[model samples]
Target: MTTRNVRFVGGPLDGRVQDLRDHEAVAGRLLKHIHLHDGPKIETQYELHYTPENGWVYFLCGTQP
Candidate 1:
């Protein structure tokens, strides 16, 4: 058996915007902008995860197209 642990570098964004919906909205906008500027398609599937301890959200994996 093998075990592995991973630690994230950044913490949650604490300020005026503290709601999950707000966060999702912001992320959605960012993704839309990225796609528009970069391209219409992405080669890899990007995973976004949220945690209470970590704060808002973070990306699990990503690859450049």
Candidate 2:
């Protein structure tokens, strides 16, 4: 399994807490879509965080070993 991290900058979640919530919602949708196609056997390990200083949204996605 491979792991990847995705980062978004200056798109929507720019120093906004509500934007972070929106980002999470979008992430959930993506997870659902992947599960639908790949079945329920895949495991996801990730973290979502927002930083006003950096002005970027980050997603850390990884698979279990």
Best by lDDT: 2
Say what the RMSD of model 1 is: 12.4
Weakest 10 consecutive residues, lDDT, candidate 1? 6-15
Off by over 4 Å in 1: 1-46
Candidate 2 wrong stretches, greater than 4 Å: 1-40, 53-58
- Could you list the CA RMSD of all candidates, in the order they appear? 12.4, 11.8
Angstrom error of the Cα, residue 63, model 1: value is: 0.9
Scored by lDDT, model 2 comes in at 0.37
Candidate 2, residues 7-65, lDDT tens digits: the string is 53232222333233433433333321123245555444434543555433444355542
- Provide the overall lDDT of each model, using Cα atoms, as 2-decimal numbers: 0.34, 0.37
lDDT of 1 at 9: 26
> Could you tell me which residue pairs clash in candidate 2?
none
TM-score top scorer: 2
